[model samples]
Target: MSKKILVILSEWGFWGEELVGPLEVLQSRNYKPVLCTPTGRRPRALPPSMDPGYKDPPLGKTVATPEMAEKVRRLDDPSNPYLANQRSLKAMLPERPYWSDLGELGYPDERGQMKMSYYPLRKWEGYCRARAQAQQALVEEFEALLLVGGSGPMIDLVNNYRVHDAILAFKQADKPIAAECYGVACLAKARNFDDPRSIIWGKHVTGHPQEYDYRDLAGVLDPETGAMLSREAGNPDRWVNFGPPFYTLEHILRDATGPEGGVHGSVGRPHSVIVDYPLITGRSTADSYTTGEKLVEVLEKGLRRYGW
Candidate 1:
């Protein structure tokens, strides 16, 4: 059946194959992809991902092909319709208000001059209702959510509550959720306010392993300004390393999956793609195509578990 997939990309940088692999597969079947970013800006592909000679440090193999590189260039082209229009997460999703001094959570202090905004019950009820409607609208409009991986997700997608809400919406609606590389961390972090535990707390998955992470050299985005250090300022190379990664995705997945669930890595295999019911995850860049195919299987073939 023809379907629409919600694709969340990192504005900072997204690995090229992560989007192309699954996208080509899904598009072949007439599936439509709706792309969005943390902000409204177009997503850029990591330069290393567009270089046919770029080899993964651990795997010792070239990760990007010439055809894949060209595809990334096409998608990145401003004239290309694929990314010309992008939905903004900030505009589309309702953000949960900070409660410490929101005035609704407690009796007004020195700063609480506005009486109209002090009704905690009313404020909460309104937020809950809006949140529910937003989630409902999201599920109704999209068949599934696919988060493309890159180091950039470490900067934006993982802890973004709006993204978490998007995940919760798909889960509530029983739609499949797929992520590759660092993008899988979102599944590990998406939790309910009441539960506190991750949605994938007991679900097997795969993501960027600690071993695959750079030990010293890493691409670090400036937290406040989104400006990354030079490949040599704002003028730096896209995938060039600046330091060490903030946190390892594999470590996060290991703790997130808990004891019952398992985390798989492609230590010896060419690719690692795990499907545990509603969630499908890929180990790293190499597994992009497989991750998309697995999502298709979940949506079309009724497959539930795979790559255990």
Candidate 2:
């Protein structure tokens, strides 16, 4: 039987192409990949930011092509058996909301229903449930875990106790794990660098550079609850903050100082891109292809050595 790989996706919005790219590579190698979300139901993709607007190369490049987007939509349709199975790419989209519906915050000036800014003031019910499901799935199936990145990650994965718990459980098992961009933020919650229990402690990994976060307006928040997206309408802040930026670099810098030291440095002058064992990470959408390529190589090498 092929090795089972579990992919965790956030329902918030557009997942980077890297998520799909790595899965494709794994399938080509005959690895069985399963997509799990907060809920077993189909999750919606965040609409392309560039749609019905300006058409540019880089923007067009990152946004899902109409065909790709359409395929995802079809998978959500009840009749799509390919998506009904656990292995379909659509299975990875998160179905359940991490928080209760808050109802429309307000209507957009243009049209469409207004969306909620934050979870309906509930503490962490939705997140807790989702985390339990993800952790249980990881334990019952899958030899490896791949946490994909997207703007939604900033809201759902970072500092969220459920995500923290899932990572903790998988790390304890010593399973091969990989993440990129906002997905890397999940590692920060694993605790201190010296704690053997911490998955990121000594591992070399890369994620959205601080520069990218700031440039993209990552952590800025609304005046009301101090939440990141409470202010925006069409786009919620949940996909922006990925938890306080403080948590992002805290564990990373500590790990970089470890024995490997100089082997891991910032990717560009601004200092993006970091890597460590059993873990491969990247900066942002720009680094998706390279990130996917590296992850495949890592998994292949590991499988070869262990005879998987």
Candidate 3:
């Protein structure tokens, strides 16, 4: 039987190669990938990511090679086999409401202990439990899970509760979980229910570094009004209007991995990927292909250690 992998994409946008590179490796080896999104919508690619010749304003150059650029174009094409017949996340794992009705549960209040009655609170709790259970079952069908990255993931996947639960499921199963670029932030955020610590609380990993961060125009306000302009409209160059990244991936990963865990900043170097048992992380766009190949190794050969 063909190996199956569960692939999650951001609804906003995804870096083209982050999805295509690893996919090429998986498909070449006959590993079937199932695509999913937060709301079951077809994910889009960022404009800069789709154009091979487009100069990254921050990097002052184009990141895609002719060969990889073509791969991205093929994957984005509506006629692409992988995308054309893909299913939604909701379809793969049906989600139900937490509680149909509310009831009085004897629980402590902010002031003291009391029987609290509320709607949606208990239901929300139940929903989380059911959702987590469903995700665990869904993950069991696949050999591994992949979280593709881009600016979009910074918006959606970072704090997505569903994505966190899915990661937890994969971790529990001891299956490989791979992420690229900003997708690595999800790993730093995902934590077990009983523990407040992150999943990578003591693991070494790599992600987009400070050197890779863009010069955010959003950091500065209008000179006269002292008010920020509309991010999409106020700035034409797409640089001076939007706020800078709230957190650097490298710093966040360093903190999440704890003092014992290491955050490898492979910036200014060749492409890099790191494997720490069940977790595989890539630094940036350049690392996408290598990330995929490493994931394949982990799944096929049970690779436990790599690039430090």
Candidate 4:
């Protein structure tokens, strides 16, 4: 049977190449991709991603070539049929929570079980985690889950319990989980509440490096509501600090993987892609194609663990 992959995209805005690069490889190999969103709505590409000449403020270079830009534009076209179709996260939910959701139950007592006391704030975490985990069985429907990245991810994908649940399920099933650029931040945040350590706590990975991050205005849109995604919509500021200038995916991955795990980055090199079994990551937009290629190798060639 042709390989089918579940691709998670942010409703806000995804970097065009981040989606196109890996997708191009997957398409060439005839791998079927099922696009999904947090709310099951169609996702859109960030405006800047379509501009081949768009200069990255920090890198001081054009991030996308004209050829790649055209490809991204085609992929993002509403009439393309791919972006036009999507599945809802709610439809995937099952009954039980994953092992991580237990942490949110009540802070987990000394024995690593839910504490007797109640944690109102944590209740939602527990609920979301459980719902996400129950959907772990959904891994059977696809070979892997690909998290595409862009500034929009910072607004929705990060700390999203459903996304975490899906990642955990993929890990439990030993299916490859691929992510790129800011999308890598989900790994750092996908931790078992009781464990104080991230799922990548001891795994080598690569992500958006500190040097790769830059300050820019990123607008997040709620595909369901057709409005700017904001926390304090009633207030004038309305969570204006959602996307800051200094946040870097590499820093979080480095700390999450702990001192034992390695976070490789291209300081002087042109590209970076790391495959550490079940977790395939890429540095930035430059590594998107390589990231997809690496994922293909892991899924098709029985490759496991590379890219120190």
| C-alpha lDDT of all candidate models, in order | 0.82, 0.51, 0.77, 0.78
The segments of candidate 4 whose C-alpha lies over 4 angstroms from its true place after superposition are 94-133, 218-246
lDDT (tens digit, per residue) of candidate 4 on 230-281? 5545535554445444376777888899988999987778988888888999
Q: For residues 78-156, what per-residue lDDT tens digits would candidate 1 score against the true structure?
A: 5787775779988777667654434644222334332345555545555566678789999988999999998889888
Task: List candidate 3 segments past 4 Å from native.
Answer: 79-81, 90-125, 217-241
What TM-score does model 4 achieve against the real structure?
0.81
Tell me the tens digit of each residue's lDDT in model 3 across 206-275: 9988888876642333323322334554565533433457687888998899989999977678777999
TM-score of 1: 0.89
Q: lDDT (0-100) at residue 32 of candidate 2? A: 79
lDDT of 2 at 41: 35
Estimate TM-scores for all models: 0.89, 0.58, 0.81, 0.81
Give the per-residue lDDT digits (tens) of candidate 2, residues 8-81: 66645435354655766787778877765544433334433213231323223344555555544554445766
Task: Give the candidate order by descending lDDT.
Answer: 1, 4, 3, 2
* Highest lDDT model number: 1
- Alpha carbon lDDT at 76, candidate 4: 77
Error of 4 at 237 (Å): 9.5
Clash list (residue pairs), candidate 2 = 154-242, 204-275, 204-276, 205-274, 205-275, 206-274, 229-237, 267-272
Model 1 CA deviation exceeding 4 Å by range: 103-116, 119-121, 220-228, 231-242
Candidate 2 local accuracy as lDDT?
0.51
